[model samples]
Target chain A: EAGVAQSPRYKIIEKRQSVAFWCNPISGHATLYWYQQILGQGPKLLIQFQNNGVVDDSQLPKDRFSAERLKGVDSTLKIQPAKLEDSAVYLCASSLEGGESAIYFGEGSWLTVV
Target chain B: AQSVAQPEDQVNVAEGNPLTVKCTYSVSGNPYLFWYVQYPNRGLQFLLKYITGDNLVKGSYGFEAEFNKSQTSFHLKKPSALVSDSALYFCAVRLYTGRRALTFGSGTRLQVQP
Candidate 1:
């Protein structure tokens, strides 16, 4: 089985610019998630999707960040008017529908906003 | 609100010695605990989880974690540390009730010396 896939292992953008990260989860996985991991910190849940609908996104910055999983197999996270504080690693993970299942993760996209 | 806390920022241990990484969590309902490992420039990997059942759960790479419901702690442990086991470890928790989203700790960096 293939692992989760993420694009542009590294990215750099100026403040106020827009950036996007892509993620393709493991085949047959029913749940997908996006997380932000700042330096010296653990991964923070940005959003979670079960199939095409969102399960949770309470912690996401609604004003600047948005994510979608249209077909439910792949997802894209976007940040508009990126700020220096947004610089972090964007990690994507997938898992089964059950609450206790272990989640598989991708390599992640490292973003640096200057 | 569910939350996790890793008390130590870093831990140093000599190879072949025992190692432990402490974690504590808070939640309203039953808690689902997880441990993940991240190597340099890599995404988080599932180490183990404790949803229910036994108190001690063994996971990949000779890692194990003890779930203490009374103390609300799930500390990662290994009997004999290896140099290759040096990495960043994160502890996470989720509530069993509605709208479950993972709450992660800051993370603990493990350094194993030869």
Candidate 2:
């Protein structure tokens, strides 16, 4: 079976510019998630989507970051007015409908803000 | 609130030797523990998880994790380490109270020397 897919394995943007990352989850997966991983740190949960509906986004920076899973199959995470601190890898993962299922992650999109 | 801690920043072991990565967690309710491996410039891959049942859970690539409820810890272990096993490992935990998000540790880098 194919794993989760993401686009633009690497990205570079200047501060104050906007960037977007895309994710296509595994087939038949019902839950999707976005995470941010800074250097030397574990991936932090940014948002979660359960069939196009948000399950959790408490850690997301609403002032600059936003994500959406349209039709519950694909997702897009956007960061507007990017800052140097936004330089990190953005990972996407998917799992089955139930909460206890194992999550599969994509290779991730690395962003470097200069 | 739930959180995870990986006490070690790095672990070094000779090939064919046993390796251990320590982790501890804090949560209000029953904890669901997980372990993931991340190669350089890649997203995390699920290693194993402990939702319930046995204290020992074996997972992909000859990896295993021991869940100690009394100590609130779940440490990843492998009997024989390989050079290919060198990577970054993360420990995560979530509550069983229907909250679907996971709290992750800073991560541990494992280095296996030949």
Best by lDDT: 1
lDDT of 2 by residue, B15-104 (tens): 999999999999998988899999987889999999899999999999999999899899999999999999999999878878477779
- Candidate 1 per-residue lDDT over residues A1-112, each given as its tens digit: 8999999899999999999999999999989999999999999999999999999998899999999999989999999989999999999999987778778899999999
The DockQ-derived docking category for candidate 1 is: medium
The stretch of ten residues in a row with the least summed lDDT in candidate 1 chain B is B94-103
True contacts kept of each: 0.75, 0.71
Clash number for model 2? 0
Clashes per candidate (backbone, < 3 Å): 0, 0
Candidate 1 chain A: worst-modelled 10 consecutive residues by lDDT: A95-104
* Interface RMSD list for the candidates: 1.2, 1.2
TM-score for chain A, candidates 1 onward in order: 0.98, 0.98
On residues A48-87, what C-alpha lDDT tens digit does candidate 2 reach at each position?
A: 9999999999999999999999898999999999999999
